[model samples]
Target: MESRKHIRSFVNQTWQLRYGAPVDDATNQIIWSFIVAVLSLGAWAGAVHSGSLPVTYGRKKALLFNNVVAIVAALIMLFSRTAQSFEMILLGRFLYGYNVGLGLSVHLMYLGECSPKKLRGVMTLTGSIFIGFGKVMGQIIGIKELMGTEEMWPYLLAISGVPAVLQFVTLLFFPETPRYLYIDKGDAEGSKKALQWLWQEDNLKLELDDMQKERESTQGEKAKTVKDVLTSRCVRWQLLTLIIPCAGVQLCGINALYFYAFDIFRESGVPEDQMHYLSIGLGATELITVTLCSFLIDRAGRKKLMGYGYLLMGVTMCALTVMLSIKDLNSWVPYVNIALIFCVICIYGLGPSGVSMALPADLFLQAWRPSAYVISGTVNWLCMFLVGMLFGYIVNGLGQFCFLIFVAYTILSAAFLIYFVPETKGKTMIEIMEDFNKLNFKNRAADTEKTDVDLATQF
Candidate 1:
């Protein structure tokens, strides 16, 4: 939503940018920047209401409804050119943001619920993989030779509708996640049928029993509200873990690094024409690495991947700062600088990019799951907007020293993970909560030393 929000401004040969803008210069700046920034706010807006929809409407149905947001948002853009109104563009961007914010979180929840624990890491992470693919596709389609031309601007904006359409059609055949049916709706027979269809197993006793244990753990608790999520003591550690990873994905400077990646390549004295292809190389590198992550996550474990990945990224950022500081010092410095930029992006993809996305679904049971997603989604989008809005100012103020901020964040986050973040690989939802409960009780030595709990649980 942020990237594609400026199609008209960047592709100035378009009719919309030439003479068709309905607004004046100040208004246009406000509208375009406002629209770009509003997408994240829109995501944050929709995210506030995300939990209610999934709990009340069911996960699949909520996502189906969200698919409509994309279709409508695209139609709004498709008509913006003909109507000669830029307000439609603003409206469209917001709706697009709303769809993605709502879709990504819910899809993760649904995918996590649908799969068995053994395959859950890879299954849930396909959400992040699909998102990476979308980013690449968006860039490819936005190329001026392709859909980014004058006549193609509106079509370029509306192309996002295609994925929603495809999902709407195919999602009909798949049942609601068996966990949702079983735990949320308390429908044993229905859940059994759904699980059978999804897992192709005649027996789901093992899975059902696990869900039952989870249900018992949250036995007296009502479905948590946003207020509930904030006020509840039991979920403190869970909330911290969720927020840390979710917010860390953005705050660790992934988006800011991508922004810097382009600048680094351009400043490397690479030709402008070749820079575009180099940009694609960077995207492809992230795509391949993140895709590889899905498979490796189940094998290597989330904490290890993230812990090591961030450590590497921290070292790379420090290296980048040195390179940027000394780019004029040597003939070969520019090339090495570009290589480190790609290396930073690659390390980002290998660990935090996908693993952080999976943390909510991995850590929470159905009772806390929806609320966890709401908080996770909200923190993630809000931090993204903060980084996007402030990083430019940050760069102006600190120059190359700005990367030291990221290094600081990595140091703090890595230390937090090592000391507190538990290894969640191969754990059931109930077991994961048990781990959080251990952390929640970590301060009280009186209650926990005799009780068995993972001492490494996240605070």
Candidate 2:
């Protein structure tokens, strides 16, 4: 879908094959938006199953299966142009969405479980780095000089399958996560071998000791369901912590900003032909910022980086609203809007983009982690769907004021991180849960006692 904006005109040109007449741009755009928005809907549906598939099949196998969906989506999309059917393209988008929903959750789970505590933040953040990289690559490939032309657009859209195929082949040799083997499957020897394979070390006593303690704490508890995550009093703060940041990822308006980038570039007097290059720059900015954050996350801590990222994003967004409002008042004002847009993306990449993805893995233990990811992935896709579908209306109705709504959301989410969510940097899962229990069990006098899944079950 990253290439959708660039390939849209080409895609619209194909509608004549179905109608036997050229469609008006208005009708074409309506259909186009549906094609784009349907991906989020599919992602939401896939996220609902993200928890169970990984829990039942294990993360590695779940991800391998997910790659097959991406392959199927690619095959369908590749033939849509030849078939002269836009419906094939729509179905392809939905399948791609489903692949992403499951991939995002299971990918995070697999990496998080495999990471040593000291390197966890950095390891998990690699996902954000790759996502940013993929966006930039999509934009680069979507350039008219490459595959964005009408004749090549279908092949460009189908390119996602190539990577899926590559991953499916390469991932077979990799070990399942040590945490999953030890804690979830109760296979101590298998876990030790996995740990050795992952870390390239013979001395894993300390690591296995930690996993044993975690396994004991979560003993007798099954992998939790999404309903359990929502309804349990034991993880109330953890759920809130996961929900707000995930929601903030969409509600913060960064995607909307990207959606409106061409308009912003137009208002700033950039040549229409040059706008795609600028879009690539925007993606590059985020990739660079997230890479920097990956290094800083463990040192500066998740809460501080996330809180400040949102706070700074709120400030940048407020400035952007003013800049957009006054663009006609001064010749240079529009350029400042462009700069502020970059700043907001940088701030988002620095904090919320990467940190939000790590929250579920950080906050929940083995039994609860799967369902926590379900909640995280669900909020993410749902909010993305709502915003993607309604943002055009919001811009038409509110104009520059649309950003103020995002500012409010960013500020509120920032405050929540600062006041409530604990920093997970360098902390063991047990330690992180204890920090959360201080808030979850704040009203109970017995909060001083050790926290366990059994206690959560008793509630």
lDDT at 383 for candidate 1? 92
**lDDT (Cα, tens digit) per residue for candidate 2, span 158-222:** 99999999999989999998999999999999999999899999999988998999999989988
Q: Which stretches of candidate 1 lie over 4 Å from their true place?
A: 1-27, 445-459
RMSD of 1: 4.7
Error of 1 at 229 (Å): 2.6
| Model 1 TM | 0.92
Worst 10 residues of 2 by lDDT: 445-454
What value does the lDDT take at residue 399 in candidate 2? 84
Deviation (Å) of 315 in candidate 2:
1.1
> Backbone clashes per model, in order?
0, 0
lDDT of 2 at 85: 77
lDDT of 2 at 237: 93
Which number leads on TM-score? 2
